[model samples]
Target chain A: MSLVEVTGLTKVFRRPVKDPGFRGALRHLVSPRYRDVTAVERVDLRIEPGEAVAYVGPNGAGKSTTVKLLTGIIVPTSGEVRVAGLSPHRDRIANARQVGVLFGQRSQLWWDLPVRESFTLLRDMYGVPDSLYRARMKRFDEVLDLGSILPVVARKLSLGQRMRADLAAALLHGPRIAYLDEPTIGLDIAVRDRVREFLRQLRDEGTTIMLTTHDLGDIEDVCERLVIIDRGRVIYDGSLAAVKDDFARERRIHLQLASPVPLASLSDRLPDAVVVAGDEPGEFTVTVDRFRQTAGAVISAVLPLAEVVELRIDEPAIEDVIRKVYAGELRLA
Target chain B: MMEYEADFWLLVLAGLLQQLVGLAFLGAVFAQVQALHGWTFTEAVLLYGFASFVFGMSPLFFDGLWRTAWLVNQGDLDYALVRPYPVMLQVSGSYVGLQGAGDVVVATCMIGWALSRADISWSPLTVLVGAVLLVSAVTIRVSVLAASCAISFWLQAPHSGFAFAINQLGTLGRYPLTIFGVALRGVLTVVIPFAFTAYFPVSWLLDPGRYWWAAIVTPLVAAYSLILGVRIYHRGVRRYESAGH
Candidate 1:
């Protein structure tokens, strides 16, 4: 059986409608209005043990709502969610014991308290054994470098330090599943790499990971499965390599020739690829499908045409593919 | 709380001064006449002390409930929800109001002095009953505050105006219920039930024959308040649609 299962899940929020100004406020006081916004609708998902899946979408695309539903932070309007055989909403405490959650935009640490206090509080709350708690803290210190920040207050820590502390807080109990929502949202590249590396290590330890992130590097580095959601619905669910092969196959090879060359000649040689002129007369770009032709083939084909001085390949980025999907340009059927 | 030592002490001082001013007012009123509405100055002080003591306990232990509106508005309660403990307990324990130390200290002194001065029979049974009633009063105060603050789940305001208004009603608990109109007395006794926190139990202790039912009613009201508070809070949590990601 899958560790996490969601069926026909839906969450509709009734937002109160208030008009502008004092007159509208006064009118609302008499009788308020509300509109139902369907944040998540009829979404079905299942995750087996030890699977690291990247859940990605644009802002307000129900990614966070789905995470909340799975973690039992908020109840659904309709449908079902089970985490480790327990109904997440109905048996929240039992479900909570099996899951770890971190919302990157928010800190779980007690604001005025030292980082160690928050960690100790979480350890007690989760009822972790003392020996195991000490061991985990040692391990976290090794990877997250949490020692320096332990005595510092939560509010005083820098963003990177805070994220590390929060990560430790979320995983102190050694939960079977960790739902990290944008865990690397606003970190510097160094910290982001460290977090991604930590996530990969966590995944290798057989923890089921449902990672929601906008950073494409997070997906490429840490996740094997990709789930792209848009407007409250899952548009694509497949292997990361498959999505790249099917939708993100376009690669551009840019070349700089020693001398100016005619575009028509190069266009004739590479019929399968699109040859576009670059800024200089000696420079041109070849856009090719990886399946039909390789970057090496394009480079060799161009080498014969002119003396190549400089060349670079623009690899197809998952960010571009996701942006197209978000813009409703790419249909991932 | 020790991080802001000055702020903590200033707040404590404010609470202590507020209570002292009220005591001075009570002394002045008593000096003008023997009693107001057949209750002596000592009895009034005891009633006032019970109300202050119950109110003080909230900031000491359950002060985090006061931030319900702010937490809900900012979606900060998300972390508490995912924890393995009870959400209500986590929320109520989130903050400790050191300022309540002053109120508790002053109220304790008032209650001790008033009990010594006021007329009452000394017995083991009376002592047990008074202790139970005192605990029940504190429970009633905390429970009512919890229920009112839970309204933030629906109101969506940053500050708990509704809860603050409800707390303001607790001020009426410091005075004699007989002096108020019947409708307001009904409100204090039944609707919001601030009277159970102070006036009802203290009145019963001072004159058991006239207010005999209050002994039983205070504990019952406490249970009801607790149940009501927990129910409202849990229901509100279910309706919490967390803010944007």
Candidate 2:
């Protein structure tokens, strides 16, 4: 059964849409300027139970807007949205009890309070029993390494730590569905991987997860399905690997050297791999088109130049694909 | 089991410390005036203390007013709505003004100083009336702001307009309502009635000889503002569209 369903979900922002200049600003205050910016237009989607789907899009592409609508923070201007067979907007309270949400840019935790206090507050707000709360915290600590940061105040925690705590808070109620918006945004790769690992566990436990992120690694690591939204509409909804194979037809190879090497010289040696920026002379990046050549072919071409202490192949990242989709190069089929 | 005991007590404890600081400031002023304006220093002190108490108590107890604008801006209210608790209670618990403590102690000291210097002591009846009226005054005052921010869900920029309007109303309540003259006072007493929150009740509590109706006005104003504020809030929620989506 589909745990989440939406049909023709449209949201229009009337606050910011205005004619240009000071004259328009003055006129707006008097007549109440309204702009009909269709944030989510005719968005139709369905997610079956226990599905781990990645929802990715460009900036201002209404990814957050869609999450807000799904979580019932804002009422929809038009359309119907249901979570666990409940209208998220109409029965927002009930829907909330069944779903956990985390937005990376902002935290729901109290700034002055310790991380544990935040989790406790959420436990109360969600009406979870103490035994279950303890059990969930124990699981989260094991999965996300939450114990190391639990004693710190929310404002004091690093962005990565705060995001991890937020994830735990969202799940304290044992929600059936989870929504994570940019959960790894602005974090180091190690931190991102830690959060991703926790998410994978949630998916394996049969929890339906709807994740929105610019980090392609998050999708590649946890989600099997991909739902790409562009210009307020879902352009592609299918297997993550298929999306990767389709628009992301390029790969990147990195070469780390034992000795310092000049950029100009490396560029002359490995023309196939563009010297993408790196720290010091030890690292250089080479982007290769899979359509033109393969990873093995690129590796053989670059192996002789650098001692090749470490070599990594970068999959076509979703960030580029999402950017392309927004640029109108990759359209939904 | 579903209680934010830590948040709750911390708010109260913080407010208590803040109120003491305010009281100490006012205490310095009292040593010089002996009396302020007309009444003995204690009566003036009592009025000031009472006002502080209400300010501190309202924010500490009913945090929704101070935080509604912020919550609405961030769409944090959405979190409250999804939870099974009453939306109002959730918002009230979201944040309390840390400065509330300063206001609380000053108010109590003012009232106590006034009682000490009063030529004639406050009768127990007058004390009873003052207590009831003070509680009512806090309710009405907070209700006005809560209603203001609740409408903020629709207003594009509500913070300045809200602060200005509430403070303007405060000018009526903070000083004697009679200072504004009969016509101005009438507008406050009837149209806005923020004047009643402090002035009418204070006059009735301290100068019972001059204002007998003040005793009756306390309960009436509290009941009116609270009911109206909540009603206005519910109406605004219906008009509320979510941020962005």
Candidate 3:
């Protein structure tokens, strides 16, 4: 059985409709109006144990709303969600024990309290045994380097430091499933690498993780599967490699020639590839479908026209596939 | 918290000074008249002190209710909802108002002085009954404040406006019920029951022969307010939709 199952889940947010100006405000007080906004519409998902899935989407695409519903922070408008065979909203306490959640845009730490104090409070709230709590803290300190910032107040910590502390707090109870929403957002390359490494380790330990992020680096480092949502609907769901193979099949090869070559000459020579001018007069680029033509074949075809001084081939990345989907340049079934 | 020790004490002192000024105003009124409305000067002081005492106890324990609006508006309550414990208890325990220490101290002094001036005979039975009434009064006061603050879930504001307005009603409990009109009297007794926290309990203590039933019914009022507060908070939480999309 899947560890997490959501079927036909939906959430409609009702917002009050008010006109402009003071007179409109007064009139609204006398007769109020509201408009219904459907944030999530009949979305279905399933996650097996020990699987790391990346949930990605544009802003206002209901990614956060779905996380809230799965964590029991907000009730769903319709359909069902079950974590560990229990409904999250109806069996909140039981579900809480099974899942750990982290929201990168928001910190769960107590604003007025120190990081250590917040962890201790969370320990007591989750009823974690003292010995197990100490062990978990030690492990987190070793991997996340949490010792230096333990005594610092939450409001005083840097963004990177806070994310590390929040990660420790969320995983304190050793939950089986973890939900991380934008865990590496707004961090330097070094900090982002550290967070990604920690997530990779967590996933290796058999913890099922659902990660939502815009940074494709995080997905490449940690998740095996990719789920792309647009306008509150899941447009693409498949393996990361499959997404790259299916939608990102084109490869670009740039060649720095010893002498200038006409773009039309190269295009005529390599009819299977699209040839375009590069940055300099002596440079040319050839774009080819990897399955249809090989880089060596394109290079052989180009070498006869101009002396090749240097050349570089670029493979299509997951980012290119996702960008195409977002721009509506490619549609996935 | 340790770093803010001085500010905490200063707040407590400010609370004490406010209550002292109120007591001074009560003293000036007594000097001009023998009684306000069939109650002696000492009897009125007792009612005022009891009301202050109960009102002060609320902040010491349940001060987090004051932040309900901020929590709901900012979507901060999301963490509390996912925890294992009851959300209400977690919310109420989130903060502690040290200023309540000053209110408690001033109220104790005022009640002691009034007991000495009033003409009541002391006994073990009276002491036990008074303790129960005091407990009941504080319970009722805290429960009412909590219930009022729970309205924030529906109002969706960043401050507890309803709770503040209801807190202002505590001023009415500082005087004898006889001075108010029949409608106001019924309101203080039945509608919100501010009288149970001050007037009724104090009236029964000063003259048991006439108002012994007030002391007996205090526990029932406390229980009713507690149930009402918990129910309203649960319903409010169910209606809670987080702040932003």
Candidate 4:
């Protein structure tokens, strides 16, 4: 059975309707009015054990709202969400014991307490055993280098250091499932890579993970399956490789010939590929569908016409496809 | 608070000064009249000390509940909700109010002095019952404050305006209930029930012949307020739509 199951989940927020200034505020005070905003609408999802699924979407796409619902932070207006065969909202404490959550925008560490004290408090709250607690802390120190920041107060840590300590705090209990929302946001390349590596190791250890991120590298490196949401709806859900193969099929090959050559000759010889002239006399770009023709075939066709001096092959990236989707240039629905 | 020792001491001094001022005002009132509304000066002081002591518990221990408005408005309660513990307990225990330490000390001294001066039959059962009633009074005071603070979940404001107004009403609990009109008396007795925090419990101790039922009613009021407080807080939690960061 799936560890997490959500069906027709919807959340509607009722906000008071007020105008921009003092007069409007006074008017609202006398006769209050409210408007209903639907943050999540009719969304359905399921995740099996030991699967790492990337939940990605544009801003205001309801990704955070979905996580809030699944973690029992907020109740849905309609529909059902079940984690480990129990309703997340109804059996919140039980569900919390089985799952770990991290929100990159916010720190779970107590603002006034040191990082180590926060972890100890959480250990008592979650009832983690002493042996497992020590083991987990040791493992976290190795990957996250938590020893340096453990004594530092939460409000005093740098963004990168706080993220590292928060990641450790979230997974300290060895939860069966981990829900991480934008866990690598605003981190340098080195820290981002470290976080991705830690997530990969966690997934390898048979922990179910649902990761929501705007960074495509996090998805490619740490997740096997991809789920894209737009306007509170899941528009695409499939394997990462399949999405790349289906939408990102075009590959570009840039070539600089030994001597000047006619662009027309290169285009005619390679009929299946589109050849464009570069600024230099010897430079040409060939765009081809990898499914129909290989880079080797394009190279061979170019070699016969002109001596190849230098060539560079560019594989299609999921980043481009997702960017186009966000820009409304490419439709996934 | 440990990081700012000077500020902590200044707040402690301020809290102690406020209680002393209230005591001086009570003394001035009694100088104008021998026994205002049939209650002696010593008995009135006991009532005042009882209310002050109960009020001090909030700042010293349950002061974190005062942050409910800020937490709900900022969506800071998100972490508490996801934790494997009661959200209310986490909020209540989040912070300690340093000023309460001073207020509790002054009120404890006042209670001791008043008991020594007041004429009452001493017995082991009476002392034990008085301790239980004092605890009940603290519970009632804390529970009412919690329920008031829960109003923030619906208000959406960063400050607990409604809760603050209700807390102001607790100041009247330090006086004898008979000094006020019936309508105000009903409000103090039933609406907010601050009267039980000091008046009723102290009344039973001072004059059991006429107020014997107050001891029974005090604990019942505490239980009712506790249940109501917990229920309102959880219900507010259900309506929580976490703010966007």
Best DockQ among the predictions, by candidate number: 1
Report the lDDT tens digits of candidate 1 across residue range A201-309.
9999999999999899999999999998888998899999988889999998989999888999999989999999999988998999999998888878888878999
Candidate 3 Cα outliers beyond 4 Å, as residue runs:
A259-265, A300-307, B117-125
Which of the two candidates, 1 or 2, achieves a greater TM-score against the reference? 1
Per-residue lDDT of A33-149 in model 2, one digit per residue for the tens? 465788999999999999999998878888998988888777788999988789876786788889888878878778778888878888888889999888888999988899989
- Clashing residue pairs in candidate 4, if any? none
Listed for each candidate, the true contacts retained, as a fraction, are: 0.73, 0.53, 0.63, 0.61
What is the per-residue lDDT of model 4 for residues A1-333, given as tens digits with 9 covering 90 to 100? 899999999988887899989999999999999998888889999999999999998999999999999999999999999998989888989988999999999999999888999999999999999999999999888887889999998999999999999999999889999999999999999889889989999999999999999999999999999999888888898899999899999999999999998988888999999999999999999999999999999988888777999999999999989999999899875
Model 2 CA deviation exceeding 4 Å by range: A15-34, A239-327, B1-49, B62-64, B70-94, B113-131, B174-176, B202-217, B234-245
Give a tens-digit lDDT track for model 3, residues B1-245.
Answer: 44478888897998899899989999999999998888888888888898889878888888888988899999988888877878888888888887787888999888999999999978898899899999999888888888999999889989887899988887798888888899989988898889899888888888888988987899899999999999998888877898667
Interface RMSD of each: 1.2, 3.4, 1.2, 1.5
Best by TM-score: 4
Provide backbone clash counts, one per model.
0, 18, 0, 0
What does the lDDT read for residue B60 in candidate 4? 86
Tell the DockQ for candidate 2: 0.28
Q: Please say which candidate is ahead in DockQ: 1 or 3.
A: 1
TM-score of model 1, chain A? 0.97
- Tens digit of lDDT per residue, candidate 4, span B123-186? 8978887888888888888998899999999887999989999989999999999999999999
How would you order the candidates by TM-score, starting with the best?
A: 4, 1, 3, 2
lDDT of 2 at A328: 81
Quote the lDDT for A33 in model 1.
Answer: 90
List DockQ, one per candidate, in order: 0.69, 0.28, 0.65, 0.67
User: Lowest summed lDDT over 10 consecutive residues: which window, candidate 1 chain A?
Assistant: A296-305
Evaluated against the true structure, the overall lDDT of model 3 is: 0.90
